[model samples]
Target: MSTGPNRIMDEFAKLMTDAAGAAQGVRKEMETAFHSQAERWLNSMDLVKREEFEAVREMAIKARDENDALLRRIEALEAKLAEKGA
Candidate 1:
């Protein structure tokens, strides 16, 4: 009688362990599927990566700064020319 109860308990513990392992596998599969779908959706929208967007933004800022510097130089040259003429 004692051995019979121990055998039942052992089987129950094994069943619980198997169930927990199966749950983990299912969870991983779900996460992988969700990530794949999200990537596909983002690709369809033609979105740029964070690094690429930042690079383009930096380029634009640099170009604007260069333009402002050139404008200032041109104005200074014009003022000097006017002074010479006067």
Candidate 2:
């Protein structure tokens, strides 16, 4: 009777250890799946990530500034033309 109880306890302990390992593996798989799905969604939307968006936004801002400067020069030239016409 004593040996029988010891063997049962040993088996239970092994089963518990195996279950724990399986659960950890399942957790890792879930994490990987979620990561893959999110990446797909982001890509499908044609959305730029934060870093890329910031770089493009900076370029746009520079272009807008340059355009404004050009507009001012054009207005100045137009004024000179009007003066010559007068």
Candidate 3:
């Protein structure tokens, strides 16, 4: 009364396919819910995003460069003044 090898394999294949489909559905739902929650939390926080932070950092670097140039100019002016006084 036992089934043949082919029938057993067919049943097993069906079971595996059903399990894979169920897992995919669960993954999609979890991904959607996670994104929704993450967006809400990110919006609630008044934080600068990565892009904005990077831009500000670049600006700071540029400002530092300009400040260094100004310092060099001031030193040169002071040196000239000392020579004139000597």
Candidate 4:
């Protein structure tokens, strides 16, 4: 009689363990599917990735800085020319 109850308890514990493992697997599958779908949808929307946006932003900043430097050079050259004329 004692052996029978112990056997039943062992079987129940194994079943619970299997159930927990299956639940974890299902959870992982669900998370993967959700992430895949989200990425696909975002791509379809044609959004710029962060890296691309940052690159473009850096280019624009560089161009602006160059423009400022060029403008200052032109102004200095004009001042020299005016001094020579006077």
Worst 10 residues of 4 by lDDT: 1-10
Model 2 misplaced stretches (Cα beyond 4 Å): 1-22
Q: Could you tell me the lDDT of residue 13 within candidate 1?
A: 95
TM-score of 2: 0.62
lDDT of each: 0.98, 0.96, 0.96, 0.98
The sequence of per-residue lDDT tens digits that candidate 4 reaches over residues 1-86 is: 44788989988999999999999999999999999999999999999999999999999999999999999999999999999999
**C-alpha lDDT (0 to 100) for residue 16 of candidate 4:** 100
Colliding pairs, model 3:
none
Candidate 1 residue lDDT tens string, 1-86? 44788989988999999999999999999999999999999999999999999999999999999999999999999999999999
RMSD (Å) of each candidate, 1 decimal: 2.0, 3.9, 3.2, 2.0
Q: How close is every model to the real structure, measured as TM-score?
A: 0.88, 0.62, 0.72, 0.87
> Candidate 2 residues 61-85, lDDT tens each?
9999999999999999999999999
Off by over 4 Å in 3: 1-9
Candidate achieving higher lDDT, 2 or 3: 2
Steric clash count of candidate 4: 0
For candidate 3, write residues 1-86 as lDDT tens digits.
44799889989999999999999999999999999999889889977889999999999999999999999999999999999999
Clashing pairs in 1: none
Q: Which candidate order results from sorting by TM-score in descending order? A: 1, 4, 3, 2
